[model samples]
Target: MAGALLSTPNRVSLERLVQVAKERGYTAQGEMFSVADMAKLAQETLGCQAELLCGGLGGPNRDGVLQHLITGHPLLIPYDEDFNHEPCQKKGHKAHWAVSAGVLIGVQNVPSPGYIEDSELPGLFHPVPGAPHQPPSFPEESSPGAIFLLSKQGKSWHYQLWDYSQVRDSNLQLTDFSPARAADGRVYVVPAGGVKAGLCGQALLLSPQEGSHQLGLGHLPQLNPAH
Candidate 1:
């Protein structure tokens, strides 16, 4: 009943998800809810495409705030840590995500946080060769928000961060959950089962100051139970 009430036809709207994200302090954002190649593959292999939402989140302390929304998936946020003892001065890093054997790994793209545009990440990560793996100083200064990662695995989900040297574990219990108020005095909800979005799916960038890029829903033929 909780999931049913939260999702219509078993799907959550991107608009609703954005509303919740804004309440949590992430204002500038982007989403990748579907991919042309992935949709094609799903149609050819299973006759039904996978419908999910993935994207980026940028704001003050957005890196830490994003951890609350990550569950068994990945989100791209501005890399907020010092690299090998140097403080990053811009949005030059990204947190990439993938799941192997049910473990969600958030790979930190060091040296240079990747760029964020109207679409998804470039999908090509070239970390510095022989990058040093040293302890990152916590409570680092805030950087402009970047991207986010989301995914699903069987019945269980998780949101964990991993780099070449360490993995930081995090989780959000969103099932049958009630609305929660963040520091902004706004109440928001994380849908039951975490919104049925995907890690590497279709996405749009969210900017509190600008409009989003849109594709006619008519063109998205693979949207099952689309919102």
Candidate 2:
């Protein structure tokens, strides 16, 4: 899904992607695909360069995610479903994947405390109702912002607007597994017994290979300087 969004005209089919993963031994019989496996598949199938970005102690930070999105590059973020702060019918240690498309900075007139409105994306953020509205804090030069996510549910894809702080906290609270760094400095999630894992906040930045198609930034919103 991510590869198809970032890649150009030459998009690989889902069946073909699975075939390639199996052929390259990226996945075994009846096993969940690891982050590294997905990255490798993106490279081979979509012709993208995947760079793993990790956060200290906490997984990926808001600034790091914003930086990557600012460059018009989509990111593959993995987080625990329970920590995502969204209403879920059934949830546990559900490790899920989401692709970030854009970001909106300096949200004005928050409807409620700790919540911001998402005019561009579907669904309004109203975590707290009737509470006094408080402005969201961001980096020194950045204003309050929200991230745009393209998430998959069953066979359909949905666009969501997630608060920056919520994203940061959820990522920090992710207790799914850990990614192991290879000798070449590449990180891969290899689930093994006795291996310390969990509380991993990481994201994979997908860059298009040379001569590949790129997503245009004209339609995406940018950070506007606060008045």
The candidate that achieves the highest TM-score relative to the unseen native structure: 2
Where in model 2 is the C-alpha error above 4 Å? Answer: 29-33, 56-61, 82-92, 107-156, 176-190, 193-199, 211-227
Determine the backbone clash count of candidate 2. Answer: 2
lDDT of 2 by residue, 113-188 (tens): 5465567865455333334444344344333443434343222346666655555555545553423222446444
Report the error of model 2 at residue 108, Å: 7.4
| Model 1 worst lDDT window (10 residues) | 166-175
Instruction: State the lDDT at 125 in candidate 2.
Output: 52
Q: State the lDDT at 179 in candidate 1.
A: 26
**All candidates' lDDT scores?**
0.26, 0.50
Q: Can you give the TM-score per candidate against the true fold?
A: 0.18, 0.58
